[model samples]
Target: MIVTPPSAEEVTGHAASMYDRDTQDDGFVFAHTQVMAINPEAHEAFESLVKAIVASIGIGVYEAATLGAARAIGSAHCLLAHGRKALRAGVLDDDGLRAFAHHDDSGFSESEQAVVRFAERLSADAASMTDADSQALRDVGFTDRQIVDITLAAAARNFFSRALLALDVPVDVVPGVSPKTAAALTARVR
Candidate 1:
């Protein structure tokens, strides 16, 4: 069955308001995330599941791979959110975050460095993935199934990030960051 598009006011009036208010509370605007304005219920459900997976796995591994992919793909949206989240996950700090912004390698462990590189290559050219790529993950002790999960995690964010970019979402979520990213995060606060 097809669900009709929500009324414009239903999204703009109520959803937009709360989203913006939350941004203000965070001192960061993320309303430009169009998912905020799409189907709220659906978005929440999808996020909940993703969070559940992260909570279960322990964030260090999952987020490193995800953010690595974000950087490879140059996704401003994912990079901003994931940068903060990674810090909060205790996977890295402000300095670490800055290093990631430039693909600097000093802040990460050798294993982490490998994972990040794998994420970058995979994100840039999943279609070109070969036995060497699989071998790299295996060398890191990731089973085939875990590698699949890592790929999914990276790809999922790609979908969301591209969607937000397509919608011309303004991000103002983190001010110390780039302007477009900040506006995309904060532009359409509720």
Candidate 2:
């Protein structure tokens, strides 16, 4: 995937508008968004799919699942972006962010740990998963609908993260997280 990402000005239609909005909201467009800008329609459709999934399971869980999947898939870009989003959503503190990679022993609840495994396994091998895999989420109080939504969120993260990595997209610099912290997360993926 040695594709060149389009500049914001190079993008047309809905994607150009989306890039503008991302810039306005975050002060800069993310590399992943810039790459998707080449096909604004597909980018919009993907955003819609992720929006639906996030709305169903809530942002916190969605971000948590994204972190797990991103880590497993070795997408440094996502690990940083979603890790920041998780922090912004009040799901984790600075110290918690530092421990996110080792989520199982990071003092997360059983439910949270389950979400991480679900996301990682789904990213690694979805076909190998059985009903019991989803049942564990239910045992932790996730509804069938929530489980489905979680699966979709993880799948969606994998889709975007893998593409960005394959394209050799660099991670955008997010504030608050030091370069050292970001480098550590990126190193884990390598």
Candidate 3:
């Protein structure tokens, strides 16, 4: 476990923090304590970014992309963390979230499919991204500005969440998905 668990009060992702209670609040706790402890301002900034991202996409699409990216990378910590919260927040259905974990192609809408594809591209091979993928995003109606923001966010999650897991931080964010996907999602390894 954690060599030194950060202060509970400093932790933002607690079980009772309006996200997941029993499931993945530990990450929130770690995130809270780490960033808030260092600079409380970061807390507000992160919150704002989260809100902006959610607002950028309708809930379904955001959750689909987030869950899809998390699962595609098999990041157990991030997967369970975001998956639970996304589902509870009505970002996605349990089935779709779980399907993402299994790398299933079905369950996502055409637009969502495109979004997830973007996330995957950024996650799997950031530097080697092909021009076609960016074009595909444009063809799908994503503006160039939005594409940049999306890429930054996806990369941030991948790097940040992976760091958290590597550091032995407790995960608190549950996968935002339907209960059905929980089984399939949980079955996959990091």
lDDT of 1 by residue, 109-157 (tens): 6666777887888778889888898688779777766676666677777
Error of 1 at 47 (Å): 1.5
Per lDDT, the best of the predicted structures is 2
When 1 and 3 are scored with lDDT, the better candidate is 1
Ranking by TM-score: 2, 1, 3
Q: What is the TM-score of each candidate against the true structure?
A: 0.73, 0.89, 0.72
Worst 10 residues of 1 by lDDT: 181-190
**How high is the lDDT of residue 8 in model 3?**
45
The count of backbone overlaps in candidate 3 is 23
Local distance difference test, candidate 3: 0.61
C-alpha lDDT of all candidate models, in order: 0.65, 0.81, 0.61
For residues 6-97, write the lDDT of model 3, one tens digit per residue: 45444454323422333263434334244234443544566567677766665666665666567656666667666776667765566766
- Cα RMSD of all models vs. native, in order, equals 6.1, 1.9, 4.7
Instruction: Compose the digit string of candidate 2's lDDT tens values, residues 45-138.
Output: 8889988988878887888788889988998888888777877788877677777765442635578779989999999998999999999999
lDDT-better candidate, 2 vs 3: 2
TM-score of 2: 0.89
